[model samples]
Target: MNNQQWTGWSSGAQQAEQHYLVEPRYLAGGGNLHHVADFLRASGWSDKSKTGGPLVFDSPDKSVRIGYDPYTQPGGWTISANPADGQEAWHATFTRQTPVEIVAGFTDALTRPRSAHAPNAWGPLQEQRWQTEQGQHFTAMSPDGGAWLQYHQSQPGQALWWAGARNEHGRIWDASFTASTPMHLIESFSAALADPQQVMRPRGHVPPSTRIRTTSVSVRPDELSAWQQARVTAARAATWARASWATTRPRHTTATGPHTQAGGRTRR
Candidate 1:
């Protein structure tokens, strides 16, 4: 298909195009993963390319290119492509977030590594896990969706690694990797936590909240009788009494009467 008219391709076409072009799919939106994938493929973008190449499309103003790179230690793919001459460029990345379960699994797998350093050398793997954790959080709250947000925020020409996990509430979370340290990953996580749907918002529109209330009623005669009986029993158990001495004393006692004390002595 011609590059200019390439956007018309469907999801199946896009998938086929990615196979033909060898480009990795990332940050797909508008429910058009395949279409976009096909477009990238027609332009010669792929996960294996170090630098993108130029391409021709139906529109003279449009130009496209794709590039790929490997991240350090924990291996991952970073793909970037753009339509420079067009109105805008599309770009995305695909990185695995090592889920907490996966991390534990990996750690267990390394327990009997062939080399002595293999067990202790899990730094790269650990970093990958951290990156996934950070990335997941970042993506969850990214203002422009996870893939695009991470791509735009990422340092040019670098892959972002991360670990993945399901939060306590069963939500997917990830940590990301960047240059120098994992601080950026932490920042992404914080941002994600603050606004989990940051990137998924409809251009300027906020999501509405949903609330639910439940009520239960019983109308059986037996249930009603039981309830009435319980109420009656409770009422009967409750009592009030005046704190006057005459009330606690014998019925013959009067307000002015003296009480008998110990040893049968009468006290006034």
Candidate 2:
């Protein structure tokens, strides 16, 4: 953790004073999409988009496809996976307004090898002492009362899990996860929501008209929160690697594969 303190607005903070704490990405609508894109590219996903069309990347084994389109209706980013070895396929879509960090949670988990044990979705929030209503249909609210997540056991074919943020004015943002969406992805998202690390935002840009009043802290113009700094560092590394690869690799390298959709989970 960076000991150097800086000021920013936080709905999750205990007071309107300077401290390190991560604000929910749903509270405001800004994040760097390039960071996640570069991460996927660096991890061996092959680009499959046309020069002027929406960006598309396919996993090396062609089991997954990720897409980003500014103008796509309903959602601008999408991920679809279909494994050939009888594993379930899953699809997820994110609205253009969905914060990149939230989406990155899923992508980050996706790239990692599957864990030997099943993931527990509620554990992350529980660790933070979030309030929960236990039942067939489960729900939990953040300690600050600004964000919440729920599981609709009865709504099997529908979106089984839904999460959102709100303030005095109204709902700021929301997302849903389908039944087929992997549990690990849901767990990763919950972990991100519960992460204690703080995000850096300009004082003037404080967001969502919070239910819990926020305090301001001082930050140097050149300083950035740890999360922000990590994204910047990843983007820089990806860019430098691409430039180096272009200069060193032969121009004739080519890849080709067929894309197929099979049975799996659906998410939104």
Candidate 3:
């Protein structure tokens, strides 16, 4: 291990605040970890150097140089990014937002300007407990399909780590690493009290209210029941009400009452 202190990025010694292009952590291959590198390869950039150099992702203009070397760290890799040339060369670490954050950080670095828009504070949308090659794994995603987080353990009640990813639309994405968490398969169910399916689910038939329609209430004259009479009267009233509502657009109106039958009997 290089005993040299890795003081990430500091503006100055007085009130020095360290910033990182990509925060370094114990290598945990997360996200499409090599996406940036893949982009480089597609751009006709080759990783084959005559002198066997560190893995590097450089912009076409050769401004941004993100280099990673596994031998630099004792049990991991060292990822660093800087500009090859320019007065603003010192702005190497300004990419604090889109820094490569996986155990696969020995990967690519992007130079796209970070979005000025604020990131959404995500709440869990979906969860699944499944078995993986390693052990039992759990995963959760956001409702918008914009973020994903996962956890895995070696055995039934063993420890695990979190790996996460968030994206800005389809372009830039981020990974997650939460340390100092003591959760079992799921130690405590203490949660924020929280928290595609293009399949069309069958819904009960709903009669449209705003849409005017004709409803036939057929009944035999000799065997008319109170309910049948009520339906026939209601159908006629509805027809009239719809006409009145459509033509006059009445501000206030009462639904006309049902007719009363003979012998002081009310039509139900």
Candidate 4:
């Protein structure tokens, strides 16, 4: 069930369109560029964008690159880490449908430097009861089998990681991280994958091929949890802080004060 009022469409033509507000658990593929971009800017990344082209950012040391291009097929957002010697290191990409919060899980951990010891990539997913098979290869799938995360040995010393969702028809969207991708980064992605928060979608706008597998509820504004309410408050506060700072600071200034994750409190 969906609440028509929650659609937020004021135009008569838009109102006439059919939509259902669905809340998906595992395979919630969507993104918030503004949220992801803000986090990057705060992490000391520099923006190098043309007036009417793609959004691009470079790390402080020029070791990483992040881009958002509208015209790109399949995936619009790309992030890669490159070493100084010019050889490419690891990289991750996201289609427009991939949730930005999950992407943030990687970036946030990236900014906050951690110990060099490798963390288990499967730990977070295992906490959520996703089944895993470990051998010459590694694979994990959602309890319902709607989504999966896997690692494959691409070469003698190189490997690739991929995650995606599907239904009867075919694949929806997929994301990948190449070899040398930090284990902590992978762990962050796993934690986000196992998060309990559900993603909202318009029932009519959901993929035609996967619609039969969706699970939803009619959530009203009042139904949000206290923690979620606090996050909304923090987002409003951050927005206000950014606006006020813009008036007195340089154009490249980062917003100050309280910051909130894209959704509820991060599991990590």
Question: What is the overall TM-score of model 1 with all chains considered together?
Answer: 0.18
Which ranges of candidate 1 are over 4 A from the true structure?
1-75, 98-268
Give the Cα lDDT of each candidate. Answer: 0.27, 0.68, 0.31, 0.67
In model 1, what lDDT does residue 102 have?
20
Off by over 4 Å in 2: 1-22, 49-53, 154-159, 202-208, 211-268
Worst-scoring 10-residue span by lDDT in model 2: 13-22
Supply every candidate's count of residue pairs whose N, Cα or C atoms clash at under 3 angstroms: 27, 8, 3, 1
**Candidate 4 per-residue C-alpha lDDT over 1-268 given as tens digits, one digit per residue, 9 for 90 to 100:** 3233433322233223233433344355564466667666655678888878888988777888888887767646788887656455888886776666677777666655565777988988888899998877799988768677899886689789988766667676677888678788889888877776655554455555444444443434333233244544554565467567758763332256455524444333
Evaluate candidate 1 by giving its C-alpha RMSD to the native, one decimal.
29.8
Give candidate 3 misplaced runs (Cα > 4 Å): 1-36, 43-53, 75-268
Q: Write the per-residue lDDT of candidate 2 for residues 1-268, one digit (tens) a residue.
A: 2344443322343333333333554565545566577677766678888888888988767888989888656647788888567657777776665666777777767765677888998999999888999877789999878788899777546546788777778766667776777898889988877766545445445554534334345444334444456655674576578568869865332255344335433431
Index of the highest-lDDT prediction:
2
Select the stronger candidate by lDDT from 1 and 2. 2
- lDDT comparing candidate 4 with the true structure: 0.67
Per-residue error (Å), model 3, residue 170: 34
lDDT (Cα, tens digit) per residue for candidate 1, span 151-233: 22344564543433332233233334342222322333333222222121111221111211111221333433353455334
Model 2, residue 67: C-alpha shift (Å): 2.1
Which order, best to worst by TM-score? 2, 4, 3, 1
